[model samples]
Target: MLLADFIRDGAARLEKLYPSPEARGLVLMLCRELLGVTNYTHVVEPRTAVPEERLPELEAALARLCAGEPIQYVLGVAEFCDRRFVVGPGVLVPRPETELLVAEAVRTLQEMELDRAPRVLDLCTGSGCIAWSIALDIRDAEVIGVDVSETALDYARKQFPQGPSFIQADVLDTEQAFPYGPFDLVVSNPPYVLERERTQMRPNVLDWEPDLALFVPDDDPLRFYRAVARWAQRFLRPGGVGLVEINEALGPETAEVFRAAGFKNVRNLPDFYQKDRFVRFQTPDNQAINN
Candidate 1:
């Protein structure tokens, strides 16, 4: 089959779910990844043909896309912080916005005193994207990622041969004691989407992503933020910093959770979209602020 024809057909089938340009982009990406063809290959080489043996595989991938499976999950990888992280049915696909949380955490760690190796903790560390990103970017940084789901932990643990230590524990289990602590930084991108917000999400996410990693009760949408505060209080060192991605609608409420936990310098930070997407705070200490 001609490569152009395949892409045209795939994009048309995918248009039912995605916009025209986006559908075309998905088809292009699929071709690039699976066929090693550049996006402009079909346009520049109109006679390019997809090998007969690979046609079936391409068709299978297009079918999955047309059925509402996310491209990342279908490809079994999601790019975050310029690195690829494995993702699948049981694990949540990392989002582009979550990269902001990683950027903030990386900047905070770099600005702090590096007299000794910095310690970091990541709560509800689905796929360990943030945790691994920080560890890889910061030399000798001790990072630990905690998640309740064994499936998520498995994916997180395998992301790097020697990155953050991935542990299995519930973020909401206040009574459970974590063996490692006294971190210089605490970070999380926990479950902040309210159940009622499902109507606002796309079917690909609703049908494919892990619900355990994406949602909270509408009546208590701030539950994960409250849990993050508890983890920060217990694990973060004096004057240490904490950052977490949040639902834009509850920015102030989420920040209040950290402030009420006795953190100072609590503030909501905007993402690329300028939405109130993250909260950063400092654990109380008499030490002078490190500029």
Candidate 2:
């Protein structure tokens, strides 16, 4: 079949679930990954034929996409912080906005210029995107990632041949005396989406992404934030920075979780869209030091 014919037909099939532009984008991304074709390959060649031997496999993938599986899952990777991270049904696909948290981390660690190598702890480190991003950007960074899901930790550990270390532990259990600490930075992109917010999400997300990495009780949307606060309070070096991605609707409330934990300079940070998407805070400079 001609490449243009498949693109048009696949997009048309997807429009039953997505808008026109997004449907086309998904089809284009699929073509790029499987057929090694550019977005405009069909347009330029005008008669580029999809190799006959690849037809069945391509059709099977297109069927999966039509079944509402995330394009990233079908492709088996997601681009985050300019690097592709391994991903699948059991893990949350790395979102673009989480890169901002990495940027904030890189900047804060750079500004510290500590005499010793910087240590970082990433709670709820699905796919280890933030952890790996920091470890790669700041070569001397000692980055560790934590997640409760064995599936997530598997993907996180497999992200790179060598980078951050992955730990299998629930971040919500803040009382555990997890041995690695006195970190220079504590960062997380935890489950901030409230249970009530599920209705607003796309099927590919609500159905495909793991609930363990996405939802929180509506009555207590700040549960993860509170756990992060306690972890920061216990393990962060005096004046060490802590940042967490938050639900936009709870920006001030989430920031208060840190403040209530006795953190200093607790404040919300906005994403590129100026929505309050993260809370940046620090341990009190007077806090007794421990490594």
Candidate 3:
């Protein structure tokens, strides 16, 4: 069948599940993924014929789409910080908003002027995107990724076997011993979406994306932040900064949580859409544990 015919049929079906623009996008991405076509406009316009072998995969993806599975889950990968990371229904798909979290991490790491390799950590690492991106960009930096999901960490280990160490552990478990970092930076895009908001999400997301990686109790939106800030106080060295992605609307509350936990230099920053999407806080004086 011709690519245009495929798109026409696929778009029509996808529209039943997604908005027009997103449906069109899925069709275009599928064309590129299956056909190795760089220019999707050509596929949409000229209507080139699809190869015989690519049919089965496209058919399966279309079926999954009709079932309200997100395209990222169907693709089994998501792009973040201009790099590909393994993703599935089991893990939260990295979003563009998280890129702001990473960019801030990179900027802060650069400013530290470390002549030697700096240590970094990505807590609640889902796909290891943030950890791997830091290692890939900073070159000399050593990164470690920690997550409670063994399945998620397994996927991350496959993606970065030697580049960064992947650990399976819950962030809130005090019995779990994290390496004494004295890390130059620690970062995360941890679950912050409120539990109540789940029903309002699009079917493609709410139906497929894992809740453990997305939603938190609305009664305590800063649960993860409070845990991570305490961890930073213990593991991060003096002047080391922690970066995190958070709900845009909760900027003040997040800042307060970090500050109350003894983190200093607390600042909330905006994403590309001008939403309060990222926060940074530095460890002060590397305080003694009792203090």
Candidate 4:
């Protein structure tokens, strides 16, 4: 079949799930990956025909898109911090907003005047995007990522030949003994989506993304934030910064969790859209726990 016809038809089929422009973009992206066609291939070569042998492959993937699978999971990768990380079922696809959290982490690690190489701890490090981004950007940095999902740790450990080490551990169990510590920076993009908020999300996310990495009980939305605070308290160096992506509706409450955990200068930070999407906190300078 002609590439133009396929693009038009596949996009129409996907329109049931995505907006008109996004559906077209998804079809174009699929063509680029599978058929080696540019976004304007059909426009430039009106007679362009999808190779006969590859048509079946295109149809199978388009069927997944029509079924409401996320494009990242369909392609098995997500872009974050200007790098692609492998992602699929059992792991949450990295979001663009999470890139801001990585940027702050990279900058914080770069500016630190540490006696030794800076160490970083990434909690709920799905796909290891945050961990790998910070480690690759900074030379000789020691980074460790913690997540409970063995599947997520699998992807995290293999993001690159040489990057952060991934460990399977529950961040919620704050008392768990960790051999690594004194992190110069601690960051996370943990599950902060409230259960009630599920209705507000599109099926591509609510259905495809792993729930373990995306939500919390509506009555206890700040559960992960509290756990993140405790982890930072135990591992983060004195004066070290802690950052966590947060639910915008619970920004002030999320910041309070860190403050209540003895964090100093707890503050809410807005994303590009100016929503309070993250919380930044610091440990008191006078205390040191050299574990």
Candidate 5:
């Protein structure tokens, strides 16, 4: 079969099954992954033959795509903050909205104006997209990513050449102590979507992504926020900052939780869609001692 014929037929099958704007894009990406052919545009310009040996691989990938496995999982990598990281059913595929979370973090770090490398923590780190991005960008900073699942940490650990640390710990455990500071910054994109909302999500997400990394109990959607805020109060240094991605509908309640935790200068940052998507807070600066 030829390349143009392959994309056309695969796209048709995906459209019939998935029926979304992402369907064609997913098929094209799968083609690139399986065929090792980077210049797909030229194949579209004319017609080119796909090697006969490649047909079986393409067919298998298309079959998996039709079965509702996410394209990222099929491809074995997810792009976030303009970098690719390995991800699969055991981990949640990173989303564009979460980039807003990373942006808020970078902005907060810059505003703090520290002269030296800072200590940073990523809670519920998942595939470590946020933690890795910070370490790569800041260069001098020491980053630690913590999650409850060792399998998730394994993928994250493989991405870093040698700088960041990964810890496996439940965030809700009352006795746990964060090893890093009095961290200069604490950031996360913890599970905020209510379990009931699963019916409303796309199959690629609801079927393939890890539920533990995506949903929260409906009764207390802010459970992670509450735990993280309390943890930060204990571990974040004086004037240190905390940030998290949140459900837009919960902005007011999130603000209340942060305030009650004694975090000052609390504010919500909106995503590209103009929804309240993240919150930032800081500990109050200590008063100077007089002579």
Candidate 6:
């Protein structure tokens, strides 16, 4: 079958789900990844043809897309921090904006003059993207990721064969004793979306992504932030930093949670869209003299 024909038909079928340009882009990406063709292959070689034997597999992929399955999950990988992360039915697909959290954490670690390897902890790590990204970016850094779901942990643990240690623990269970401690940096992108905000999300996400990694109760939208603050209080070393992705609507409140927990330098950070997407806080320097 001709590549152009496949592209045309696939885009037409996906038009109802995505905008015209986006549909075409998805189709082009699918073709490039599955058939090893360039994005502009059809443009450059209008006569390019898909291998007859490969047509069935391509059609199967198109059917999945038409059914609103996310392309990343359909392809079994998602790109984060210029790295590919394994993702499937049980784990959350890593988002581009969460890369900002990794960037900020990396910058914080770089600025600190530590004599030994820096210890970092990631809370509610669905796919260990932040944990593994930090581990790979920082030399000799110790990184650990915590998640409650065994399924999510399975995916996170395999992301890097010898990368961050992925552990199973409930972040919201304050009563449970967390064994890891005294981290130089603590980061998380927990469930910040409120139940009431479900309408704002697309069906692709609502249907495919893990709810445990995506949402919070409507009455307490900042629950995970509160838990993150508590975790930082116990695990973060003096003058250490904490960063977490947050719901845009609860930015100020989320920052306040850290401040109220006695963290210093608590502030809200913006994502690429200039929205209140993250909160950064620092633990008090315990060595400072209290004159």
Q: Which candidate achieves the best TM-score against the true structure?
A: 2
Off by over 4 Å in 6: 287-291
Tens digit per residue, CA lDDT, model 5, 203-248: 7788778889889999989999988887787777888888989988
Prediction 1 global C-alpha lDDT? 0.90
In lDDT terms, how accurate is model 3?
A: 0.82
Q: Compute each candidate's TM-score over C-alphas.
A: 0.97, 0.98, 0.93, 0.97, 0.94, 0.97
Q: Per-residue lDDT for 46 in model 5?
A: 55
Report the alpha-carbon TM-score of model 5 versus the true structure: 0.94
Candidate 4 residue pairs in backbone clash: none
Model 5 residue 120 CA deviation in Å:
0.5
Candidate closer to the true structure by lDDT (higher is better), 4 or 6: 6
Q: Taking the tens digit of each residue's C-alpha lDDT, what string does model 3 give over 47-148?
A: 577778889988998888889887778888888888888788677788887777777788888899988899998899988888888888888888989999
lDDT (tens digit, per residue) of candidate 2 on 1-291 = 999999999999999999999999999998999999999999999899999999898999999999999989998999998899999989999887899999999999999988989999999998999999999999988999999999999999998899899999988898897989889899999999989999999998988899999999999889898888888878898989999999999988888888778887889999989999999998878683332
* lDDT, candidate 4, 44-89, per-residue tens: 9999999999999999999999999988888888878878889989
List candidate 5 segments past 4 Å from native.
36-45, 287-291
Task: Report the lDDT tens digits of candidate 1 across residue range 54-126.
Answer: 9999899999999999999888899899999999899999989998888889899989967999999999998
Q: Pick the candidate with the highest lDDT.
A: 2
- Which model is ahead, 5 or 6, in terms of lDDT? 6
lDDT of 6 by residue, 208-258 (tens): 998988989999888888888888877888889999899999889899998
Q: CA lDDT, every prediction?
A: 0.90, 0.91, 0.82, 0.88, 0.83, 0.90
lDDT-best of 4 and 5: 4
Task: Quote the RMSD, in angstroms, for model 3.
Answer: 1.9
